[model samples]
Target: MPTPLAETLTQLRIGNQKFLIDFYQRSRHLFARWAQRKHQLPPDKAHGLLQDTLLDFYDHVADGRITRMPEDLRAYLYGMAQERIAAHVPAHQPLPAAEASRRQRLLAQFNQLSTDCQQVLTYFYFRGYHFEKMGGKMGFPNATVARRQKSVCLRKLYDLVRGGYEPITGEVV
Candidate 1:
């Protein structure tokens, strides 16, 4: 039988593997650990760092970095995971002018949306919530409502983008 730490590491490895297969699903095991760790924060800065590291691992699952890892090879698997996460995480690099301009334009358009619309859109897209869950959270009966609302919001956002709104000065782009 493996040691307690070994078992935990194995679970972590298994989670990373599962994530590689399907990134859309949230890892409840990891989330549970994070919730526990969250309660121990301030004094548990190390736990916080581990949580951050594990989140990066979740990102790796999306990038297919966790398939076929053998838990017995502890050092190698951990190193591989670290490498994969490092590659997947965004670097603190400067954005090109064109990219920066595009981002600014997008942000300006996004800002034009109503607060509720923005939240729904964010939850649906950025947080990767399914329509059913999103609708329930937003108090809609079903995914159909969520979908319709999303479409409406998207159209408004598209119009704002096409209309070319400007940031800072709130001028038309």
Candidate 2:
């Protein structure tokens, strides 16, 4: 009773490993090339974007957000990819003076963080690593540990930026 796309979506939702594997194999290279050529993203970034897009697609199907079969699955995926790319890549315009100063202050405070905190934040934010990957790289026992560490580090950074502590004196500033 179901169309091919509906069946595919059902398989994806039910965690059909073979179907997922085939889908990834069929889509990955084409999507990567499209991302690189259309968006001018580097190969590594494009690949990372592809991973994120696929995960998002899977989540949508699993969560019933994408219940109906799209007219064209590839186009649907590409649309999601474009949205992801736009969200992550900032515009090239220069910042306002005040914003620039704020960013400078943030960077200074960022530099004052512990090396472990800096690395955790950098890997999670700049590199787009999930907590599991971050845990392996940072030698945390599990993703929960990595996630907790990131939360703690992010809170520390926020406190520093909010002037909760004096950078030099460790006193409230």
What lDDT does the true structure give each of the candidates? 0.53, 0.71
- Tens-digit lDDT track for model 2 on 96-160? 78955864677678777777887787677645589999999999999999999899888888998
The model with the greatest TM-score is 2
Candidate 2's TM-score reads 0.45
**Candidate 1 lDDT, 1-173, residue by residue in tens:** 53343333333332324332332134334433543554433424433334455455543442346443444532443353355445764423344789658756776677677766776776666555799998888888889988888888777788778874533222211
Model 1 residue runs over 4 Å out of place are 1-93, 164-173
Best by lDDT: 2
Q: Pull out the clashing pairs in model 2.
A: none
Question: Where in model 2 is the C-alpha error above 4 Å?
Answer: 1-3, 89-173
Clashing residue pairs, candidate 1? 164-173
